[model samples]
Target: MKSNTPRMPGRPKRQDQDMPVQETVLFTASRLFMELGYEAVSLQQIAKACGVTKASIYYYFDGKPQLFTASVSAVLERARTSTSQILVQPLPLRERLIKVSEAKLARSHGDFETILREARSSLSQKQLDEITSKEEMIHDCLAEHLIKAMDAGEIRRTDPLLTAHAFSAVLMLGIREIAKGTPADKLARDIVDLFWDGLSIR
Candidate 1:
């Protein structure tokens, strides 16, 4: 006669067990790439950070170029989603622009200039084009919203594409202010006030 017995749970599952290895690698690689720049980071470093092997990384990505592109793409996708949400708010155009600027500044942590410069050497032309295309999509999204605001007479009529580019540049500059310990709310207001003073239709 056999006695019925409940099987004990094996080792407790790790909190990250539910996450796929590829996703883990992507996230870890993105942080490393941002912190260390593209050329300075390596698959071995990422693998160790993710608690996996270099071969495991290769299983998910072809090489460093592919991983770097994927990591940057992940960041852009997140920024796109956040920008979309901010743009869709029912706030006034100026307020929406401020919020968007704040969001962009909040997300700008990496040494982007280094990443972009280094990526050109490591990434293929197609990969470089893809990155540029993603950037253009963000610009185009802003431009589309600017065009709508102009049509509504909420702001002065201007070249939406050029205006969008200018707005993005100004917001990028705000990152320096953030580094200087200026509050994001204050920076946002200052940026919007300065931009509106010039762009607003009296």
Candidate 2:
């Protein structure tokens, strides 16, 4: 006995099937790791979340470490791409910096430092280096933009990489529990303003 209800109209239900299998696995792993951190989330969980069997996960990754490395590397690569795009815009250096900070602060990600610290023993040297390399690309991209800003007299000359690192540190500071209730934009502005005071031409 067929019911008289009509099926929902939208992109076909097979949209899930259309997602590349490896991509689905990596994305699921990334979210789980972000939400639960490395030690807690398991391959079984990721496989279940991806709607694939555990063997299917093993087919794509040798084990948890490989999958973790791939997921983190993918995250960092995407970050670098987005950071590069934002910094390349015509906005002023301070505005771009604020935009970058606001963009990152608005997004939810696990505490990367804590997660890496927790997972340090599990990650191989090569995998660690790969992750570090991917992370540095974002810093290096920001540094390049900063050097240009310095040369243009938008900010006074300073060590570009160190300044880039400092900005990131301030962002980290702004997101911690102490600043929990502050709006992302206000926090970003406060940080950039404090930063600009230091770098502004005397």
Candidate 3:
């Protein structure tokens, strides 16, 4: 006499139970690509790190090129989302700019750009265009906010696009300082102070 108990479809056996194999592969590949550069990392290494086989990674992404493209795109998408959120806040332009600057400074420590530069030749034209489109979206968001600020008399009147570019350049300087072991909070404050002082209406 055996008791019948419904065993709940014994939790499907995935490569990683906590996350989908495809997402795991993407995240693992992204980290490796950023840390080792595209040329240095192999699919085998990423698969091993993700507790799956090399074939598993290939199943999700066509190859190394696609994997790299997907990885960089993921990072850029996150940046775009973050910037968009900051832009939509009802705060003054200076406050929003500081927030955006702080967010960029924090994220700039990643080696996403290094991976892109190293893998440029391997990436397809379409992949390059996709990356460019995402980047342009971020810049456009910043420029839009700057234009609004100008119209509201919160900042000095200037070419919004040019001003946004200049602001980005200044924020990039903070990234350099961050790489040199400068505290991000301190650097962010200094950057915001310098940028706001220069752009603020007297």
Predicted structure with the largest lDDT when compared to the true one: 2
- The weakest ten consecutive residues by lDDT in model 3 span 7-16
Judged by TM-score relative to the true structure, which candidate is superior, 1 or 3?
1
Candidate order by decreasing TM-score: 2, 1, 3
The C-alpha stretches of model 1 lying farther than 4 A from their native spots are: 1-16
- Lowest-sum lDDT 10-residue window in model 1: 6-15
Residues 79-193, model 1: lDDT tens digits: 7778888998999988898898888777547556557897788789999888878777888888989999999999899999898888877877787788788888889889989
- Taking the tens digit of each residue's C-alpha lDDT, what string does model 2 give over 1-202? 7657664442122344768888998988988887678999999899888887787788778899999999988988888888999999999998898899888877676677778888889999999999999988888998999989988888898999998888888877876732367788888889899989999899
Cα RMSD to native, each candidate?
6.0, 7.1, 5.3
Stretches of candidate 2 off by over 4 Å are 1-16, 177-179
Score residue 102 of candidate 1 by CA lDDT.
81
Global lDDT of model 1: 0.81
Where does candidate 2 have its weakest 10-residue lDDT segment? 7-16
lDDT of 2: 0.84
Q: Measured by C-alpha RMSD in angstroms, how accurate is candidate 2?
A: 7.1
lDDT of model 2 at residue 61?
87
Sort order, lDDT high to low: 2, 1, 3
For residue 169, model 1's alpha carbon misses the true position, in angstroms, by 1.2
